[model samples]
Target chain A: DVKVTQSSRYLVKRTGEKVFLECVQDMDHENMFWYRQDPGLGLRLIYFSYDVKMKEKGDIPEGYSVSREKKERFSLILESASTNQTSMYLCASSPSDSSYEQYFGPGTRLTVT
Target chain B: AQSVTQLDSQVPVFEEAPVELRCNYSSSVSVYLFWYVQYPNQGLQLLLKYLSGSTLVKGINGFEAEFNKSQTSFHLRKPSVHISDTAEYFCAVTEGNSGYSTLTFGKGTMLLVSP
Candidate 1:
C-alpha cells in the first residue's frame, strides 16, 4: 500500500503570518501536487512539482509557493497567510509515466484568523 | 485543457437503496476519468477509473462507474448503498496528451445515506 503523510492535520494562523504545509510519500512518485478544496469551488490546483526543484503554477497559484528539494517530500508555503487562504489543503502524488492514478494524503485544514 | 462537471451537488438516499452520481467532462483529446470518495475528515480515495480497454470500471466498496465517450459522461452507480457509503464524491479528468499529470476536478457531490 502507498502511504502519503501530511505534516499537520489541522492548523491555525493569524493574518499576515507565514504558514507551511508539508507532505511526504513513501512511494517515491515523481509527481507531487497541492490543491485547495472549497465548498462549491471544488479542488483547485495550487501548485505541482514534477521533479526536484521544478514547479509549475496551476489554476490558482496566487499567494502560494511550493518546494520539492527531495523526491519524497513536497512542501506548500504561504508567504503571508490571509483569512481568504483558510481552506482544506490536499497533497497528492503519482508516478511520472502513469499519471492516471494518484494517491492522496490526509488533508490539512488551515484556519486563518 | 480538461474540465469536469458533477451534475448534482448532493444526492440523498436510504440504506439498501440504489444511487447514481452524475459526472461530465470536456476535453478535446482522449482523457482519463476518475471518481474519488472522501470520507468525513479523510483524504480522497480512488473509487474507480476509466483508463482504457473497458468502459465500465468497478472499484472498491461495491462502487462502479461507466464511461460514455459519446455522452462525455462518467457516472458512478451503486446498487445497494449503506450508511457507511455517505461521503463526498468527486469526478476528475486529465488529458492524455498533456505531459504533466494535472487533474481537473468537479465540484464534489455529497452523498447522504440515511437508515
Candidate 2:
C-alpha cells in the first residue's frame, strides 16, 4: 500500500503570514502534485514536480510556490498568506510509468484570518 | 488540453436504489479517464479507471463505469447503494500518451444516500 502523509491536518494563519504545507510519500513515485479544493471549484492544481528541482505550473499557480529538494518530500509555500487562500490542500503522488493514477494524502484544511 | 465535466452537482438516492453519476470529457487526443470518491474530511480515492482494452470497467465498492468514445462520456453506476456510499465523486481525464501526466478534473458530484 502507498502512503502519502501531510505535515498538518489543519492550520490557521493570519493575513500576511508565510505558510508551508509539506507532503511525503513512501512509494518513491516520480511525480508529486499540490492542489487546493474549494466548494463548486473541485480541485485546482497549484504546482507539480516531476523530479528533484523540476517544477511546473498548473492552471492556478498564483501566490504559491513549490519545492522538491528530495524525491520523497514536496513542499508547497505561500509567500504571504491571504484570506482567499484558505481552503483544503491535497498532496498526491504517482509513478511516472504507471497509468496516471494518483494516490492522494489526507488533506490539510488551512484557515487564513 | 484535456477537460472533464460532471453534469450533475448532486444526486439523492435511497438505500438499495440504483444510481448513476454522469461525466463527460473533451480532448484532442486519446485520454485516460478516472472516477474518484471522497468522504467528508478525507482525500480522494480512486474508484475506477478506464485505460484501454475494456470499455466497461469495474472498480472497488461495487461500482462501475462505461467509457463511450463517440459521446465522450464515462458514466458511473451502482446497482444498489447504501447509506455509507454517500460521498463526493469526481471525474478526471489526462492525455493517454503523454509521458508526463497532469489530470484535469471536473467539479464533483455529491451523492447523498439516505435510509
Candidate 3:
C-alpha cells in the first residue's frame, strides 16, 4: 500500500511568521504535488515536483514555494504566513511512467492568526 | 482551458438509499474524467476515473460513474449508500493525451447520508 505522511496534522502560526509543511511518500513515485483545499473552492494545486531539485508552479503558487531535495521528501514553505493563507494543505504522489493515480497524505490544517 | 461543474452543492439522503451526483465539463479538446471522495477531516481519495473505452466505469466502494460525450457529463451513482459513504465528492477533469496529469477540479458536492 502507498503511504503518504505529513509533518503536522494541525498548525497555528502568527501573521508574518515563516512556516514549513513537510510531506513524505513511502512509494518511490516521481511526481509529487502540493495542493490547498478550501471550503467551496475545492482542491487547488500550489506546486509539483517531477524529480529531485526540479519544481514547477501550479495554478496558485503565490505566497508559497516548494523544495524537493530528495526523492521521497517534499516540503512547502510559506515565505510569510498570512490569515488569508489558512486552509487544509494536501500532498500527493504518483508514478511518473506508470499510473496517473495520485496517492494523498492525510493533510495539514493550517491556521494563521 | 478545462473546467468542471458539479451541479449539486449538497445532497442529503437516507441510508441505503440510491444517490447520484451530477457533473459537467467544458473543454474544447478531449479530457479525462475523475471522481474523488474525501471523508470528514480526511484527504481526497480516488473513487474512479474514465480514461477511454468504457462509458460506464466502476470504482472502489461500489461506486460508479458514466461518461457521456454528447452531454459533456459524468455523473456518479451508487445503488445503496451507507453512513460511512457520507463525504465530499469532487469532479475533476484533465487534458487527455497529455504527458502530465494536471487535474482541474470542481467546487465539490457534499453528500450527507442519514441513518
Candidate 4:
C-alpha cells in the first residue's frame, strides 16, 4: 500500500524560532506538496517540488520554504515561527502525471507561541 | 488560473438523510475536478474525481459527484449519510492537460451527521 508519513504529529515553537516539518512518501512519486489548513480558509498550498532540488512557490508561500534532497522526502521550513503560522500542515505526493490523485500524510499541527 | 468555491460552510443532517454538498469553479480552460473528505484530525482522502468522458462519477463510501461544464459546477451528493460520514469535504480543480498536478481547492464544507 502507498503511504505518506510526517515526522511529527504535533509541534510547539516560540516566536522567531526556526522550525522544520518533514514528510516522506514510500510511493516513489515525483511530485510532492505542502499545504497549511486553517479554519474557514481551508488548505492553502505553501510549496511544491516536482523533482529533487526543484521547487515552486504556491499561492501562499510568503512565510515558508521547502527542501527536497531526495525523491521520497520533502521538508517545509519556517524561517521564523510566528503566531499567525500556527496551523495544521499537510503533505501530499502524486505521480508526475496530473491524472493521479495525491496521497496525503496524516498531518502536523504546529502551535507557534 | 483556476479557482474553486464550496457554497456552504456547514450542513447539519440526521442519519440516513440524503445530502448534497455544492461546489463551483472558475477557470478559463478545461479542468479536472475532485472531491476530498477530511476526517477529524486526519489527512484528506479522495472521494471522487471528474476527469473526462462521463459527466457523473461514483466514488468510495457510496458518494458521487456530477460535472456540469456549462454551469461551471461539480456538486457532490449521497443518497444517504451515516453518522460516521461526518467530516469536511473539499472541492478542488486543476487545469486539465497540464504537465503538473497542482490543485486549487475550495474553502470546504463541514458535514455534521447526527443520529
Could you list the chain B TM-scores for each candidate?
Answer: 0.96, 0.97, 0.97, 0.97
If scored against the real structure, what TM-score would every candidate get?
0.98, 0.99, 0.96, 0.98
Clashing pairs in 1: none
How good is model 3 by TM-score?
0.96
Candidate 4 chain B minimal-lDDT segment of 10 residues: B94-103
Predicted candidate 2 versus true structure: per-residue lDDT over B1-115, tens digit per residue: 7889999999999999999999999999888999999999999999999999899999999999999999999999999999999999999999957546899899999999999
Give the lDDT of residue B8 in candidate 4.
100
Candidate 4, B-chain TM: 0.97
lDDT of 4 by residue, B29-100 (tens): 998999999999899999999989999999999999999999999999999999999999999998856455
| TM-score of model number 4 | 0.98
Clashes of 3: 0
Q: Per-prediction DockQ, in order? A: 0.72, 0.78, 0.62, 0.72
* lDDT, candidate 1, B22-104, per-residue tens: 99999998999999999999999998888898899999999999999999999999999999999999999998564567889
The better-scoring model by TM-score among 1 and 2 is 2
lDDT of 1 by residue, A1-113 (tens): 99999999999999999899999999978889999999999899999998989999999999999999999999999999999999999999988785568899999999999
Shift of residue B36 alpha carbon in model 4, Å: 0.3
Candidate 4 CAPRI-style tier: medium
Model 1 chain B: ten consecutive residues of lowest lDDT: B94-103
Q: Estimate, for each residue in A1-113, the C-alpha lDDT of model 2 and write its tens digit.
A: 99999999999999999999999999999999999999999999999999999999998999999999999999999999999999999999999985899999999999999
lDDT of 3 by residue, B1-115 (tens): 8999999999999999999999999999988899999999888899999988999999999999999999999999999999999999999998855445777889999999999
Q: Residue A45 deviation, candidate 3, in Å? A: 0.8
